[model samples]
Target: MIFAMVNVLAPIFAITLIGFVLGRSKIELHAGTLSTTVLLVATPALIFSSLTSYGVTPTMLLEMAAAAILCLSASAVLSMLTIKMFGLSMRSFLPSLMLPNSGNMGLPLVMLAFGDEGLKLGVSYFFFVALVQHSVGFSIASGSYSMSHLLKQPLIYAVAAVILVSTTGIAVPEVVLTTTEILGGMMVPAMLILLGSSLAGLTISDLRPALVVAVSRLVIGVLSALAVIWVLGLEGRVAGVVFLLSTMPTAIITYVFAQRYRPEPGQIASAVVASTLLTFGCLPFLLWFAVKVLEQS
Candidate 1:
């Protein structure tokens, strides 16, 4: 188990470190442009590869879809409760507090820990999360919902592709699949490098509030996930997968939204970094606990 954890976490940590070094080196890499490129090109390829390589099953698809809906609904309710309890202003509450960076951070972590099986679940969850991020998440972040932006996401296109392949029985061409595999291979390293670079700009003062948010996200998210899985009677790997997805740190995309709509970019950035770091400690324990519980049952 220890070895497995190390094997999974080492590469992610390494790539994140590289990103940090690059960011701190005073290099002129435009973080936004690089992030945009990842979103547009690398991410799509990665999603295509994952979906094609791990053919979706009816059970897997339905369970994952249900899980995604449940998780999002839970998150929305939690966010609203937090907003009211803390007396956060609309400007402060909308963008800074809601949504997780399920793409770059969450997906990679899932792939690392759970392999192809996890990837299948992660992709399905991501599709739903992306939709919520655009619709409910965007509405919270931007103070107004925009259907246009939500409808046009590349991630949505990827989901559409999955549906098309599943429903129509269309096989991806070998050449295209090969190309996607090659390009998709670069995504993890590139994403980690970006994450590390972003971290380079972080300071102690920036992390104080972020620490609080990170703890809240982890504790609340994990507990909620546990409750949902237990109630749903998920067992073994399925339960483990749900727990991992639930415990993922705040999404980096939250930073983009925060920058646009909220005043606490520092806090959001800190939350992203803090969660990324902390998950390394928390997720393994959660996985173990889930496995133990499922096994005992």
Candidate 2:
């Protein structure tokens, strides 16, 4: 279990740390271009490549999607309770708490922990998380909803295409799969570097409230994932993927949303940094438990 945990987590830490070093060293990397490439190019390719090969029927895919939604709903409800208990403003904190870092931090962990089949399941979980993040999560953060923003994401079409081919029994060409698999390979490591760099640039002005939110996010995340998994009777790779993803740190993007649309951007930044630090601190133990205990569940 110890070896498994280290094997899974070491590359993530190293890649992210290199990004942090680059950010702090004042090197001029085109982070925006990289972000766009990941979003528009790599992400869609990843969705198509991994999910198309998932080997599950459309019904099973829908079941995974439903499971993801249940996990998110659990987090939202539990997050609201945490917010009210702490007297935090719902508008400022709800989106941040409800939306975990399922993309950058999540994919790598699942891929490493459970291999290809796990990546496929993790992609399904990520799809719904992204969907909710753009729709309901965006509304909560921005105080208004825009269908336009969600529609613009390429992964939507990517997933749609995957489902179309999957349900219709139309086999995708092998050349496309190989091409996409290559492109999809870049998504995780690039996102990790970007995540580390973005986090390194954030400044946390206050520690107390940040700690409060951080703890709440982690605790609610684990409890919510467990509750959902248990209630749904989810087990094996599906359960493991959902569990790891839900327990990820508060997404770095929450600060971006707060900066653009909500108040307390600085506080959000603080929470992002604090929560990430705390999550990583507890991750070895969390990983251990997942391998020793949750893996069998």
Best by TM-score: 2
Please write out the lDDT profile of model 1 over residues 77-134, one tens digit for every residue. Answer: 7766776766555555433344665666666777877677877777777777777777
Task: Give per-model TM-scores.
Answer: 0.89, 0.97
Clashing pairs in 2: none
Candidate 1, residue 104: how far the Cα is off, in Å: 2.3
List, residue by residue over 16-42, the lDDT tens digit for candidate 2: 998899888869877778988998999
Q: In order, what lDDT does every prediction score?
A: 0.71, 0.86
- Model 1 regions more than 4 Å off: 94-98, 204-208, 290-297
The number of clashing residue pairs in model 2 is 0
Question: What local lDDT score does residue 196 receive in model 2, on the 0 to 100 scale?
Answer: 90
Residue 164's lDDT within candidate 2 is 90
- Candidate 1 is scored at a TM of 0.89
